[model samples]
Target: MNDLTLSSLTGRTVLVTGATSGIGYETARLLAERGATVLLHGRTDGEARAAADRMIATAGVNGERLCTYGADFALLDEVHALAARVNANHPRLDVLVNNAGTAAPERHTLTADGNEIAFQVNFLAHYLLTHLLEAALTSDPGGRVVNVSSSMHRTGAIQWNDPQRARRYSRVAAYAQSQLALTVFAADPRVTAVSVHPGVCDTAMLPLYAHEGCAPAEGAAHLVRLCDPATEIVNGAYYDRDQRVEPAPRATDERTVKRLNKLADAAVGVGS
Candidate 1:
């Protein structure tokens, strides 16, 4: 909410995943209103298009400033396709917001790609998408990535040997682990990136945080601030809402960051 005026984002292009609902939707709307060309992503093409249409109709966002893209993050193939489409369409993406996520189901589930459902959807998919879009993301000096991580990462520990948790599984632990890995990924040397906890907001994931929460727009304000070029940032930094703060100790460990990259690359078939 730091006076992010309309002219602040002119000529910038941002891609926000999970943009069909909650904080993601509000973030996309705010960016588009501020003159950024926003790409809205959802689980499917229909859902993404509908979100863009809704923004145009209700928020008065210019249709020309919004575009729609979709891919089911549960599948690695779809994530690759999503990245390819974005790279082909926008050669110089200014910001990539890794916001798509899902709560772990009570009954443990596994994706066809052989990863825990929450792990694949919440972390691995974005990991792959971000790596694949390297050419476009690095096309400009100002390009960067913003990971919408969570404070819950503090309670999580990576199950290095059995990341899928095939032998033992708890919904809460699974979700927390995914968020922790995402936070650690910010330290990756491949791209200039940072992670943030956008505050507990009244969104689909609110139940995981608290009984009551602030509005989605309030959470989105923090994200939009990080995306602004005027706001200086350090690679691998973590933020709590609008304040730059330390993340979980493990998240900033260089060794952990390298290990997570290796694990994620293998899990997502990055080099294969």
Candidate 2:
């Protein structure tokens, strides 16, 4: 084992949603280089395939270890379909990286299922997917779930009564709330749910959202570290550069977290 390089992620299988671009792609590439069997998940087949190819190309793989699963995170039906596919194919998915995310520049955009796009894509989608794959995630004692969040989660409040941003709208706040929800969602004790702020990378997402930071690789490195078994105890926390950081006051509120859990369960029609 000592002879193996860092790219020797042998025997490990990782499923990274939103692996097409940004921190998602960088994390996939890093895992691939380490020899992990990475399953790429994206909203579209074309994008997902492209990202899988890119990871293979970038990681200098000989055969296809990185795969793709096409699922639109913004839709509950798609999330269900994805769960079925993943369960059937992946016996024990080592890591569930909820890295795929979106932010709406417009006010209160809804998905095909009529939920807020940001809420659905950034938070609800994972809620549904993870619930469906709970068995797979917890099957292994060391299984992990890493959610890519943003520092913007600090500025927003959990609008339990109006989480969908139905009556009002600010693109930034909406996005921030979604991210914040992700952070709070990590409260689950069974399957380790982790949140990360990738520290400003120059990805297309940054241009659209105008986020400030270094590069995708730099931000992704922090996320990648969470994949290590040593970091397993760092669950249920927010991180930057692999360092545990304080979440917003709202995230730390036990009552608020319990309420959000109940609300999220109701939204997903599961554990309430």
Candidate 3:
């Protein structure tokens, strides 16, 4: 044990993906500073290892709680493996955070999994990860899945006709669609889920932003609260900063959420 004790999270465990930087990083750091054993995710070994080191070096926790996993969210197989690794060690997960995301630059880039890059990384990856971990989450008193999303979700909707973006993909459009789906996923009650906008934090992704203002730490505060069990009623909502905002009409559909979850399962090969 160390000098700092986040006794508030004395026995809880949280997994944060894309945690090497920005909002995800800040959230993981705060959780570690307290008492929650946080699992941080990065897409590369170097990034993952570096993030874990930084969390430890910076947080100064009692036990070694912050560790990193290198899984590219753009690939389904990798997500499955990432889930397996987490499940192998933790019997039940108190918190599962889907915080990794990216925006493509003006071009259509396909990932190794043969799907649009933005779609796969932002939505599909989180979808598979959450489904695979549902058993772990639901097995608990009532686990939470904090799907890191953005206010941009209001700018787009799910293409019930073709979610894969088979016709044409724009960077903004693709990313927005994924986030919208994330918002929908978070609303499901089988396992508590909520999508959060990290309040325009000063993370690396800011370069991708058309507008600016919010800092990452400020945005992460809401995410931290969402992780707390006391805030159970906030489930299935999209958090813009600290307050919950309504998702688009498409995001509020049970059939759409279920359909998207099914597509995600087929892509990653799993079930609800």
Candidate 4:
């Protein structure tokens, strides 16, 4: 094990979603290198398995010790099944990095679940996953949930009357709304959650907005820092890159949090 990773992450188990590419991919590799048992997730079996293989080889861990899981975040059923699988197999999870996201900057689309695709993929799936796996996380003495939000959410607001954006929608609005909701969800008192803006990294999603920013490694570094057990970030706070920042006023509003919780509970059929 690399000395740094070995010291900070050895014996810890971390699950990073969207680990097949971009910041997620780099974050998984870094965690694996540091000696954490990393569960890599993707929307496809082949890509996730391949990522697992690379991590095993790179980290010099036994192939049998590394694992991968798949689920299409666009589908809530798949998200539930994923949570069940992880909860069943890994009873103790020290960290969960909800880094998966989508960008449909041109238009709005709906998932089979009737929720906006970006809303479901970027926010709802992760919200449900974290809720279902709360036990696994809380079982550990020092557990953390890192939600990958974005600075773009600064201008976003959830449409209370049209949460699905069925009346009218744009990719930008949907994406930002989803991100803001996610940051709000992270405020759940049941878990020690930290939401982050991984910076505008050069990734596949960048082209959706025709923007370029930092390297994926640089973006992943911020996530890795938050995941570090020794870091001093306040639970339920938001960060831009590594610096904590105030989210949009709507995100901090008390009513905003409650309304989001109610909607999420209904969307995932949690309390029903």
lDDT of each residue in 186-268, candidate 2, tens digit only: 86665687788887788755854565757788787787778765455556888866678888878757787778778877887
Tell me which of candidates 2 and 4 scores higher on lDDT: 4
In candidate 1, what are the lDDT values of residues 59-111, reduced to their tens digit?
A: 99999999999899999999989999999999889999999999999988999
Kindly report the root-mean-square deviation of model 1 from the true structure over all alpha carbons: 1.2
* Candidate 1: segments with Cα more than 4 A from true spot: none
| Candidate 2 wrong stretches, greater than 4 Å | 1-7, 139-141, 207-212
- Which pairs in model 1 have colliding backbones? none
| Per-candidate TM-score against the hidden true structure | 0.98, 0.92, 0.90, 0.92
| Candidate 1 structure lDDT | 0.93
Clashes per model (N, Cα, C within 3 A): 0, 5, 8, 1
How many clashes would you count in candidate 2?
5
- Summarize candidate 3's per-residue lDDT along 92-206 as a digit string, tens digits: 7899989898875577787888777887888888888887887777445547888888888889877767777778677788888878888888877666777888667677667
Clash-forming residue pairs, model 3: 2-62, 6-34, 6-35, 187-236, 200-214, 201-215, 201-216, 202-216
Candidate 4 is scored at a TM of 0.92
Which one is best on TM-score? 1
lDDT (Cα, tens digit) per residue for candidate 4, span 27-76: 98877766678889999878899888876776565565457999999989
Candidate 2 CA-lDDT value: 0.79
lDDT for 128 in candidate 1 is 94
Question: Candidate 4: what lDDT?
Answer: 0.84
**Model 4: which ten-residue window has the lowest total lDDT?**
1-10
Candidate 4, superposed: residue stretches over 4 Å from native = 1-6, 57-65, 139-141, 208-210
